[model samples]
Target: MPETIWWKTGTVYQVYPRSFQDTNGDGVGDLPGITARLEHLAWLGVDAVWISPFYRSPMADFGYDVADYRAVDPLFGTLEDFDALIAEAHRRKLKVILDFVPNHSSIAHPWFVESRASRENPKRDWYLWRDPAPDGGPPNNWLSNFGGPAWTRDEASGQYYYHAFLAEQPDLNWRNPEVRAAMHDVLRFWLERGVDGFRVDVIWHLIKDEGFRDNPQNPDFAPHQPGINRFSQVYSCDRPEVIEVISGMRAVLREFGERVLIGEIYLPVERLVTYYGPDLEAADLPFNFQLLETPWQADAVAALVAEYEAALPEGGWPNWVLGNHDRPRIAARVGDAQARVAAMLLLTLRGTPTLYYGDEIGLGHVPIPPDRVQDPWERNEPGHGRDPVRTPMQWDDSRHAGFSAVEPWLPQTEDAERRNVDAMRDDSRSILTLYRRLLSLRRDHPALSVGGWRSVPLPPSLATEVFAYERFEGDETLRILLNFGSAERSIPLEDDAAKQETWSVLLSTRPGRAGEATGNVLHLSPDEGVVLRAHPSS
Candidate 1:
């Protein structure tokens, strides 16, 4: 078996703080709630728990906007609560990763407050600020990701400041040496507290073009897309200088030893791979989101996997994400039946996998009433809100899905009564059980964890709807088959082992299928996925 590292071989579970669990009945989850629920993650078999930001903030962007990088928000808990949570999580052998927001800060941050106070302030250059155009309008044609112009007028300073998302969240001037040093200090602070790593938010947007040039219009821009897509962000983000900044962060992490750095990058595989840095020193994992953008068909997904696998630089570790707080759940995106198949695909792929908090029990999107809508993006662009995916986690069939005594900050899924950890843990056919089984397999088999992988060729007729691959370590080989279609299919094994090998079903998404034996031709039910171990006929 190859040398293994915790980040390379372990799965990461994302815990969205506000919606995970509420210990104080504040309708919002806090540090204590997460600490209390550490047992659940340990029981679920994930290797690490990545908690979204609990830093002090005004919640303009739901904790993405940081106010105090060093302190936990009062709403989440005090610094002591965070310390206790870390201690408990470490005691359980679960690595803790914090969401480190480096791109922007809330307008209320002391640095931003001082920057906006006056153009002549000592910290005035801490954020991106520019003079108005000759026409007395905004500085540039840049558009905010949330809606209008990326530049917001600071009437007090009589200067326009840039904000990539909301006006209340201003982009920091990363070119400033002081800003970079301060952000680096934030990473050291958490590292000192024993955090296993950080998921660096918008790491690609750290440095912008020095010339303040306007982004050219995207010729393929469509009306249905967000306004920010109207122009390609060539100058606004992903500048070449950003790599050095990341390398600096990597240097700081190396000081702490074995600390992982995960960057939240949304670029194409070509650009995304560059974040790995020279000799793989920058981002340990740039977070692959190809599964989110690809068409949910067997052939399309298969091609995506092959492409991502080919794109990785030599020795550069790969990672995969199926669902997150920002996107629609996999169950909603591909429907419930195929979600089980997706779980198999995500967990068995040749990389690290990130599981969204409620995905283990198959939580789909919950409809948000207009009165209950909370995502600021929805206010900026109607119908584009992410509230549906960011709802409270369904723990049980209790009031507020056992998430809170009072109403949850967001509503629960429609099927929370039946689709919860407590309800699914005992159900053999439930998605949660399937997840646990798969996780256990990963733990028990080196072939499933730190193994070499190769695509398994299927017959042309089955290739369009049946995707197959093999994970092998030394003498152990495991084959994974996924049926993306709704019709029953039989896949023929064409390999020349005298055509008399017996395949044992180690695990199957469909219930009552494990321990079943199959001949050269393997059968599959609609939307079913199975992991098979081939035993040569004696």
Candidate 2:
């Protein structure tokens, strides 16, 4: 890897706009607030910021269901505010990537409104619409990702429309060229506005099965929610035609120099890699979500790393995301103590690492009272809601967790005082400090940022509890060792001759240590990890 490779040398920080900062005292984060915080992010040492959707929407699915793709949402400030934010980010040498919602649009959108007005409307074919069964039931057994039936009936037209999500989010008919052109126009809108790139939402679901056939039944479905065990949805998403559309999107991105396009795909490694396209004319980065699905084990993680590396496309850029607005924080998923180890693994890996908001401070999931839950998915499915992860970011120990002057849209965590940026900024041992150090180290070292990765097989005695790998660039080699278990472990380096020389520890989770190394054999405490670079002079 070379430093010139854009994806290899940058750290991306994801910001969930609504919970980031609120300057208007209206209890919602806006673009102006983000502009005000550009200096803080620049000081923290990130190369780019991926802001979640803030486009004009109906709030049915927050900003995911866009009603107007070209304008900023009123709740998130004006178009001028967005321009200021982008300008400020560029001034701080940070790239700004806006979220692009292309799979569906709010029903209130003018296109959908016209499409659903009547069967004779010119835009009727823009969205998926079909006749109902003779018995007045849905056309097929498709199910929404959120819950319930995927199709909603329209009384005026005597038909039903397909929606893989909420009914208010009508799925766009990608089979229509007009719809594709319209989406491309939306892309041009942001590109012309000087946005560095886009984080495409549900990119895989842009096209559906052309035949509109019924999906297979999911035999392993649980009874926790309605339609959980109903259909497999194999044909409803990730259609082959998606690749062609993505190629077109990549073509548009090429017109702008050094612009990036990342896709949100939840498929397996094999399917996910296809989003890179056959000729590398697709998403610049298809999110590697192995951390989201993999079991937290030494062997499991090691195997997953090897598998993902092997599966990547030729010349394809790699990226990793441990936490996001849609998923629980890595700290809560693997316990607070293991969070540091997770961060080390993320930063040391061979890809651009994306850190979710508040993850640096070890923010846990906020308990959303049943009545206070605002997430539509969680509200519809009480037990399986993602509200816990989507809570307001804890900035300080204020009444509203310093997120808003009034009550936040979502409830703040009770322990926000102890787990906020203000408190952790001065605490040397806090997770925030560890993140800052690790990010700084990654930025300072070309070996850590753009080096080739090779898994260092530990001795059988150490393999069960320890996961280690070597990242090399020319003659320089950096070894990263992590103990996934809760006990002391010592691992012998397989290449004893290579390790005979003294090594300088670059970074570690253990406190009060900087560049300390002993010999070929190294000792690690429970959940402790270190990054060591072999010293050539010694």
Candidate 3:
């Protein structure tokens, strides 16, 4: 039998470069700083690390606005530094995935700069541009993700350029043959440098409606939702033509054997599966962000997972994420105790799992003061900034949480002193210990790694407050149970005959929970989660 790909069976850890570590004393994390901390990840047992964009940029939208896809940004150190980081990570048996932003580039990029110079410029077709509507406003009703109109008028060219995100990041015209070719070359550049894969950013927006048609309004949009939610994004993104563009990127990855491509697509489960392409030619994983965005209720999360599993096409694989740099931390979303349960769920689920940095230590969103805010989105839309979750890593109780010698670019969480890698390492009851335990169990047991997932029935009374699922591989089966409520509950085990058999506790969220039992009912404390191996023999 052929061995499964690392990305398929391994967990990926995401590191936000600016906040991971700082070895330069400049209050900013660089590639070398990441290199210095590779041991921590190896100790934590993550299978891979996906670093966000670190390419040359003008700091418009952090590194998301790419000025030079081919060069390493000075803030992140030289190309040599990135090379060293990759070498060190591989030496520790970890695969490295880089963030690829094909939807747009920094406005200062030469292609965009030349395109704006004149309508006749040779590079004009490299980016999306359109003449203003009769009203002399934007070309369409498309809105920028940061807020306001998506099109910024280019006065010199008597036209407007479209930007799905910040005006500083102009959308690339993937419809153009030259634009597609250039982006493919960018993939080759990284592959040649030995990147295991890419996490393509805003991949759904690669090809928009050719007619520049207006996007329809989302009827379900609530007033409290983000401004962009007002539009259904029908014409602005997820066009049918995107499949071809994704296939092209996939072809580049195919040239390098054993590599992977992950898409950052946020769409309904049905539409999201299309990115897999016929026969799985698109992304290896169209990142499943449900665990991050779904409601925290047991029933809702279970339904989302079941729905997503049913929607996946043949040859398509699923992935899970609890949190990322763009959203609030998992601990912040579900409270500290439940975060441990989330970790257990992420690792045991039947797919590749992506772990955001700092999540293992139960890090939550930190409050950012108005005076020190650095996120552009927060500046554009006051309460919507991502700065809180992008704060420096809490490494120790030392000054600045040991992330930097001087002040960090962003503030650390208020509990930084107590909730850090150093503090959690020796404490068996800590969230970090729970994460390491879960990861180790996943690696040691096939039932927890590549097993098939099936829901285990519980009593109707416990269904809403408790989640129970069984992972089966070969003859071994592992069951995981999580309690979301604040009181103790006895979860009924449906199999009366199996009650005659013994079950051994593999691990539990609560510290010091280890034993074997033979019973029809399992007692679970509030916010408790446990994994048990069933011995079916009489």
Q: Candidate 1, residues 256-318: lDDT per residue as tens digits? A: 988889999999989999999888878999988889889999999889888888989999888
lDDT of 2: 0.86
lDDT of 3 by residue, 84-129 (tens): 9989999999999999999999998988889888888899989888
- Write candidate 2's Cα lDDT for 428-486 as tens digits: 89888889898998887777898788998877777778899988887888889999999
Assess candidate 2 and give its TM-score to the true structure.
0.97
Model 3 TM-score (2 dp)? 0.98
lDDT of each: 0.91, 0.86, 0.89
RMSD of every candidate to native, in Å, equals: 1.3, 1.6, 1.3
lDDT of 1: 0.91
Which parts of model 1 have CA positions greater than 4 angstroms off?
A: 497-501
Q: Would you give me the overall lDDT of model 3?
A: 0.89
